[model samples]
Target chain A: MIAASFGAGGMNMLDSQSRDLIVGHGSHRYKVDVHWGRLDPGRVPVKDCHEMAVDSQGRIVLLTNHIRNNIIIYSKKGKLLQSWGTEYPGAHGLTLMNEGGEDMLYITDTERHEVIKTTIDGRVLMVLPYPAEVDAYEDASQYLPTETAIAANGDIYIADGYGQQCILHYNARGELLNAFGGKGIEEDKFENAHGICIDTRSGKPELLITARQQNKLKRFSPEGKWLANIDLPGAYICRPVIKGEHVYLATIWSGDGAENTGFISILDKNNRLISAPGGNQPIYHQGNLSPMYQQLQLFKHPHDVCIDEDENLYVAQWNAGHLYPFKLIRI
Target chain B: MKAKHRGHSSILFLQKIALAVCSIVALWGCSTNKTFSQENDIRLSAPIPQYSSTLFEDSFCLSFAPGYPNSHIHFTTDGNMPSRKSAIFTGKQCFTQSIHLKAISFHPHLQASEMVEIDFLQVKRLEKVKAISLLQEPSDSYPGGGASSLFDLQKGSLNFREKAWMGFDEKVVEIQLEFEKPQKLSQLSLSTLQDHGSWIFLPEKMEVISQDGSVLSQWPIPQLAEAKRLAYLHVSLDEIETQSLRIRITNADVIPDWHPGAGHRPWLFIDEVILK
Candidate 1:
């Protein structure tokens, strides 16, 4: 596996089959994720980050849980860039894309019960308010969007993380294509699909989705197939980001507030843990630190992550208002 | 000679004084028709500025006047945020007809505010509630799946728990709800663990029995593919009201290949059975 680094510069054509590590770290200052999700043990609650996306500029975007209104941006060096959006009272997962020639943001507000698309500047571009056909919800605060994945055609895959709890498919133009994925525990099905990724790990583009509660990763063809389910571990194993030969994920081990400590695990193509990213660090478990001796250099509650051509890591931290970015070097 | 010089100078001074008086009179007379008037101070206290309510086609527009003509007024319906567009005042209704004028005030930066707020509006049909789920159960039954629950709540009476239904082979769940009267239902919504379609289910058995243990109706045999998992079910609430209606489904079929026979045991999840 390539060694990991935290900063700057290089250009080498890399293959999609290369090995890489997803490093992680958490801080005590910028944990604006929730009341219990602060950095210090007196405040921060437990929240593992989930579903992340990389911008064209190589920045990372993160979405936190336990009372949405969580969003954070960061540079490759893990510097907190700009962060806003504590509006999703019931927020779950988040994804980013380019719309009007810029890194556009799409967030699923499970509480407000709507899907919002905005510019990086936080201007509301389009609001695909609650869809009508899905038998989702009629109440204002019931439509919960857990995660979102983009298709090449701009179609959006919305994981109904909470509320109606289903996978909703929409066209790039924000039209309802088809709505699937609901409450179940099956190989071809999902119990709680907390994470989703549309990757080309296969020769062709396919949907590499993770069912958090099921501890399984299922890949589907673009048309939505029950292709296969790979195994993963942890109680609340969340969204999966498919890198070269490995798939990265976040798993929650403790509390429910911002201070809750989480672990990040990497799985090979066969879905086996290569190494746990934040598993070695001191997690703020119930006031004192939960002593994990692994000493992973930099990570905590890695809810979501992404890899670029340069092997840089862009992670969206859980309970953090900002994203932490690192790079996998020649270690 | 002295007298003549004094007279000429005095005459010139008097002429200058007369011209100044004439100009002053002209300025004073120009203020008559202008009332600071046209009720420029007339302002509205309702129908907030940026608020929008699509409750009606031709909604009522609350307006104000007698105040600043175009001094920049701002308001909110959904609170704090005004609509994107800016509207000018004809002094009669600068906002829209639908705004309840819940609250209005001159934008603070524009100087003063003669604010007005209307009481909660009678929002004739303010919002339309399409469906309401009666079941709200959370499930972590599947390993390696998601945090999403097995089913959502809806306007039904049969919840999976009350129906003795969990899940089945191919992970398909058969749902059946019973009521007292016959209801015309054109559509039925069922949510699988990771899916959201297919209403008709293969039945090993479909029988509706009354509280007296009498069979009210026996569902016909059918062939429907086994579903991924049963999430939520939706059927119209337009019929009978049997306090206790038993819906039995067993020996289910997975695919809609052959007609579903009364063979294998099927799952029965009745979330909310509503009878009209």
Candidate 2:
């Protein structure tokens, strides 16, 4: 194991392979390794390891609410390469987008109530403030964007999950193009529009947004038309990560009221649950998929999933102590 | 111009009073458990009870991880909530028969944690139960291991979504348990999950009846209505010898009006049923 290093002091490396717990179901099974990113809490503390993404260079980037080092970059072998960012106190979401040839990151800070586009090395390129141009936002605090999806044409779609619960669309230059998907109980509206992604599974890029509180994944047109909904009862899922023909999600919670209950769900091109990594085997009764829950205690409140090129899953959790990310080696 | 200036000054005075009153009301709202100060709002997690074996041969020692360092734990044996004034847990206590242990953790600034209950039963010369038939089956989502779950000699944790819980929705559950021979039953108790915000509530009532449809004994399960991690309901029955028994539990049916999901069907979750 590499010697663990933090801000100034060195800490002992953690070895969690002794647990030897095997988790998941079907072809997506994995052996768990919980000590992948353990850090010294005094020097580099983490409140919530919220979201993670793998850049084109195959480096794993993690985002946490801890202001000391909000962004942590790790090698594929679970070695800490570097860490940066102290301006984001509520760094909740991280999305990596490639523009032209270089990788750019869009970070949504709930405390800042803004979406920031930055170079991979922590240089702020652009910042998108609350859409004061829209009538829904009375002030900046009412626009806590949680996640963003970038289009191929360089447009940004922001999900105001913790605030007015709407989606704000913006052009590349931080100009408002259109804003839709406000808070409501209808199919087009949302309760917690936590995450969004551009789906290219059908070759025609569409919007796959997570209505987290409603436990459904909604597909919308580029112009914000409600197309279809893939209902996952009892699964309050987070963002959708598309890897090739399959879609993966880190279900943040299940059961009720944001308890420490979660699982990793994998869906096929048809949007049907093919496997659940930490939950029971997905069983469909009649035409509805049975409510799924965590069977093994492998995860608690999994906020995001980052799958490397080797198909291994790195799970970032929330409210599960100050523990580090858990790596699931694909079997 | 002087009269108009006075009028504007009076309006400004009235606005100041309104703002003061609003701030007071907001502060009062925050004081009533709806919100708490960060210093005093430290998490007092429920105690995790560990046993040598939930189904032990004779007697078993009960041990658990402390909720926090230097915290005191008080527990009870009669299925009541534990308070700071309750008996402190010194070490392992030897018990002759079955018992229900309810514990609470206390810290300096943190609020007392909700009670955590663990039940231990001692099997003796009682007849073996054969099968159990339900009038209405539980939800397909949580079938709970079918008939074997009742006396499987296992317990569930705070996470009721595990396979240990038998969950039912929208309907009451009536069960008929058949025994191989007549046996004496003096006590019956079970654990249920109570998370009002999650639409899982405690049972409304519990009743025991004979195989001939005569009411044997009945008791009302108290409705805490608040968020509790777990609830253990134990009712002492007069010693009765019976070949079979019928158990009936009334469901919450609808979420209470105070809850967010008012008028909607709530869930009923029961894990293990212990008898002696």
Candidate 3:
């Protein structure tokens, strides 16, 4: 176990000169630097820093609900490079995709009940409104999209997590192709389908949707068929970020959904929990992962995690005193 | 003159080194003190109790959250604050009667967490209850297994979406309980939930009236500064004998101004009603 050497005072002095606090276990350990993304709140204020993505330029882009500046761009070294977008008041999810040499972003706004496709520089490219075509939705109010995942073929998958609890699949031209997984306790259904990501680790694209409240990730075929479930036990994972042979998730809650008990979960290529940063060490007995809980107060409510090329992690939080993201330098 | 200048410069360099050492010592001292203070603020997470229901019959097995290495969970059944000397919870405990269970988690290097308390009522099953009816229907969103749920020995969690809680948004709710014969009743308890974050509040008052139109007991719930989890409100009756009883629950007309749902009608959720 890592010793609890640093305290609240050490965190406050987390500039370049302070000693590093190492967290996590095994090969996934990181040097925690809480002030890596600090910005002057007056000049670039944020509220509920929801999610983040890495652009083609390697610059970290943050999506927040604050209308003053919805998207804040920062360099890998934590320097503020640019900020834009006043339109996304409920910007909750961000997915950056490099389409044939052009970097595009898909922003899901819950308040607008729409998934917007925009250029990296904040210009609107396409808008996919509420899927009124779905029989479960009566109006646009019942379809609050929280996250979006784009497949390699430009197919879009949106998770209506805060609303009807369904996953809407669309083609490249924003045409609805299929919608499935409504609210239920069934294997194919979802409770809080908060996030979605296309997993191509097996060399074939499959949808990994977050059944967050159930503490499991429901895998589905591209056509919205049940594939399998990756049970995370006590981790209320927000989304799955597949990089290389690992799956990184920002667990928003741990241990019966307690408040302010968020952590980061890392899974091996076989979907087994290997490490949990800010949480108890992952243990498995006879192939069943033990229930995990917060072991440290390193995070409040981690909403999303962005991994850079150097394997460093940028964690954005939700309702965590409106603080900026914390950078976890891989050790 | 050159040698004297060199001597002065050497003295200045020594002073600078001494100042750096002093600053480092001061910073280290400050960091150590902050670590101690922060360690004092580190609280163990409250242990969650696992039970089918708070209302149980005969003996029920109650277990708590799994313990961590070097940490202990102490508990008491007599309503007192749990201390280090309290009974250590190893596994499921069997209880035969109503108890106010309070538990606390303690670690050698961290502060003890706040007490997590619950009142588990040992109900008699009320075999004499002939029928139960509600004057006004509960909200469709939360029917809570119908009016019979009041005596069904089911308990609701903090989540209102659970089917065990009967939620009402109206200003008042009336329930009638018919008995096979006149039975002596001394105490009446109602298990309710209060989650102001979800606009669910405890009732303002509750009245138990006899079949003869006389008020047997009345309880005015005190307004709380903040929301709490599940609560068990008890009212002492005057050992009244009646063939039937009427339960009148008055909901809070408006949420307090301090709440986010101020001026809006608050919901009232009740799960179990025990007559002893």
Candidate 4:
């Protein structure tokens, strides 16, 4: 790493370098590094890097829609390790779960309207097709799953964000258990339910679903009953990635829903926003969050953020000129 | 004494030359690190503007996005392009008359951003209108307050999902406005939005007809480059006197082939209609 002093004369030189750019608010500052995961586009092309996750061996695995190579694995120090898979034309979401001391992957393909379970090395374990058991879906074409959350008991919860806007629950054997939450503006219904994850911070596993277009995160019981709602005005959040006591999300758009306005949002244990990396400082007045907007042009259309064991952040973008993931080294 | 003074003056001149050389070397080092390619890659984004409405009766407050360190926002009110020498916007400004505003952002080490322009119109209240009704209804998804929305004097943002915009997918839309008596009118302005990402476009053609079904005036919109923003189309009426008028709007039958939604029906959105 190159470090330079920003004296009276060399201010312009230090301003242009990305290594010296530190972002985020109090207690969560980070130094941005744009050249962390850059690779040759001709050899390994990427089209809309959607999501990322870290495996058991501490490898960063990224998912893209490019049919050439859908999954690209990298080391923590920005080295290309391996790549695999080509069948997922619409590979949107990637979820990693440790089962029986082995890491398993859940890939959601929007074009195929299904979810597939695979081992870390790209071996298919099981496939869950469209939920014909649900009455809201007339056929398989109406169920376009975007994300999935696996429970401790091997149960699966899928969010059909593009199609019927319903959350489908299934057992470990790929059998449908319960389905709820259709498309509407009501408190129980959802609008653009793009992501889902299980939050265990409260000692009980509750479903946290992303209502992206409405800029809200809804909480539901394990049996699909509405619990509460967290309102984030002007933030079009994508997914909920839970760490030890905080929740990190990638906001796709903010401030009047304009294009190419994105930021990273971090919430504390009490579910209140604490820091926003590329946005304004989080301010609350009488237990309500003020509207948030992009203050710095650091990211465009950020889709997901993966936090490593050291609390560093890896951000993946969509429709940002096919750029690679940017790394935020914790300061 | 003269020789000693000359020697001291020469020493001072030499020291000034050395300092000048050092300053030049420092500037050259900074230039080498900041290449032209790198400057082009990280251009600053245009500032986002906020206002209560584009059409106001008396006045409105215009504000910009939040600020950051080492960046400045400059603006102009006469429709000229904004430059670094323009007025710096410190906070929200109140305007009392119609004006065309343009703004741009600049940073220390990055290229300047493109200009953002908006037009705010000062309108007069019309009390001669009696009843207004829509002959053709809008889409079910975007009702937008029904027929009263056209005369509500409110404007919608770029997000078409907002309730102020009335979206129509039909080929032809007709609206009837009846006055208590015949009134003289010279111009008509309609506020619309064009957000290609959401598949919303402006109307193709507009016509004003008298009570006898005779065309009084017409305006045909010309095809232009694709842009995502709001617009105001002004139509000249020639000061014709009429009690009842029918305003007809035509939508594009098929979207252009270059768009993502090619060969599909284009949506037309209108928020408010004004008569002067």
- What would the TM-scores of all predictions be? 0.42, 0.57, 0.83, 0.82
Candidate 2 accuracy as lDDT: 0.76
DockQ for each numbered candidate: 0.01, 0.02, 0.08, 0.11
Q: Write the per-residue lDDT of candidate 4 for residues A260-296, one digit (tens) a residue.
A: 7899999999899999888878999999999988876
lDDT of 2 by residue, A76-152 (tens): 87788888999999799899998998999999999998999999999999999888988888999898899999999
Clashing pairs in 3: none
Which ranges in model 1 have alpha carbons more than 4 Å from their true place?
A1-52, A63-71, A99-101, A136-142, A254-261, A278-300, A308-330, B1-276
Query: Which number leads on TM-score?
Result: 3
How do the residues B37-70 of candidate 1 rate in per-residue lDDT, one tens digit apiece? Answer: 1122112111222223212234444443223223
Error of 4 at A262 (Å): 1.4
Candidate 3 residue-wise lDDT, A1-331, digit = tens: 0011111222232223322344677889876667788999999999999999999999999999999999999999789999999999889989999999999999999998889999999999999998888899999989889999999889999999999998998999999999999999999999899999999999988999999999999999999999999999999999999889999999998876766778999999999999888787798999999898876667889999999998989999998988999888786
Please give the distance, in angstroms, between residue B65's alpha carbon in candidate 1 and its true position after superposition.
78
Tell me the TM-score for chain B of model 3.
0.79
True contacts kept of each: 0.00, 0.00, 0.00, 0.11
Interface RMSD, all candidates in order, equals 32.1, 21.3, 12.7, 14.1
All predictions: root-mean-square deviation over Cα? Answer: 27.1, 20.4, 6.4, 8.4
C-alpha positional error of residue A101 in candidate 4 after TM-score superposition, expressed in Å: 2.9
DockQ for model 1 equals 0.01
Weakest ten-residue segment in model 3 chain B by summed lDDT: B28-37
Assess candidate 1 and give its lDDT: 0.46
